[model samples]
Target: MGIFDWKHWVVILIVVVLVFGTKKLKGLGSDIGESIKGFRKAMNDEEKPAEATTPPAATPLNQPTTIDAQAQKVEEPARKD
Candidate 1:
């Protein structure tokens, strides 16, 4: 659904102004502004590295890449039996 109309917005704003005085409201606005700035900086930093870097190819270590070592060992003993 759409947002509430102007009447609801005015009532909410008046309640906020009454609950938090003019000075506190100003401080809250600054705090919210700083948080948004920090979030933007972090998002920009993440985008830069994704374009600049290529990850190394993954390699299977200490075993054949296609066959699981534990499965092979189990089957080997069954074949002998």
Candidate 2:
């Protein structure tokens, strides 16, 4: 025999109704429908590909890297007159 018969289906439905209640079941259905709609839209939108990111070229070994001297200085607060 098949796994699902009319009796089994009815019993499952009754159990679900008892657990979730009618109002919650209605809200669940609406939420599921919205999720499905959003999934479909995202799938369709994926037809257009986004731009690829490229890495920067490496600097020459001979050229020395420049350091900001100002960055090393820690300024002390001035005394009030």
Candidate 3:
């Protein structure tokens, strides 16, 4: 028989159940189920086309655009002698 025969799988299942207990196993099962459901939902959401959104208002051609930004000083690392 192959290594993954029915008897070997049954024994492995028994050992796993005995090691983890029923309550923890049940909670783990539900957590796995919820995560799988969430994954499927995210996949479905990704597959669907996004809704149309209004485009930003266009600026007047006569007005020049101004950009505001802050500059930060970066310290140089000390040279190792």
User: Model-by-model lDDT, in order?
Assistant: 0.85, 0.89, 0.93
- Candidate with the larger TM-score of 2 and 3: 3
TM-score of 2: 0.56
lDDT-better candidate, 1 vs 2:
2
Best candidate per lDDT, number? 3
TM-score, per-candidate, Cα-based: 0.52, 0.56, 0.63
Which consecutive 10 residues in model 2 have the weakest lDDT in total? 47-56
Q: In candidate 1, which residue ranges exceed 4 Å CA deviation? A: 1-3, 50-81
Q: What's model 1's lDDT at 31?
A: 100
Cα lDDT for residue 53, candidate 2:
41
**Candidate number achieving the greatest TM-score relative to the actual structure:** 3
Residues 1-81 of candidate 1 have per-residue lDDT tens digits of 348888889999999999998999999999999999999999998889665777788776876756545534434444553
Kindly list the per-residue Cα lDDT of model 3 for residues 31-73, writing each as its tens digit: 9999999999999878876655455898899999889999999
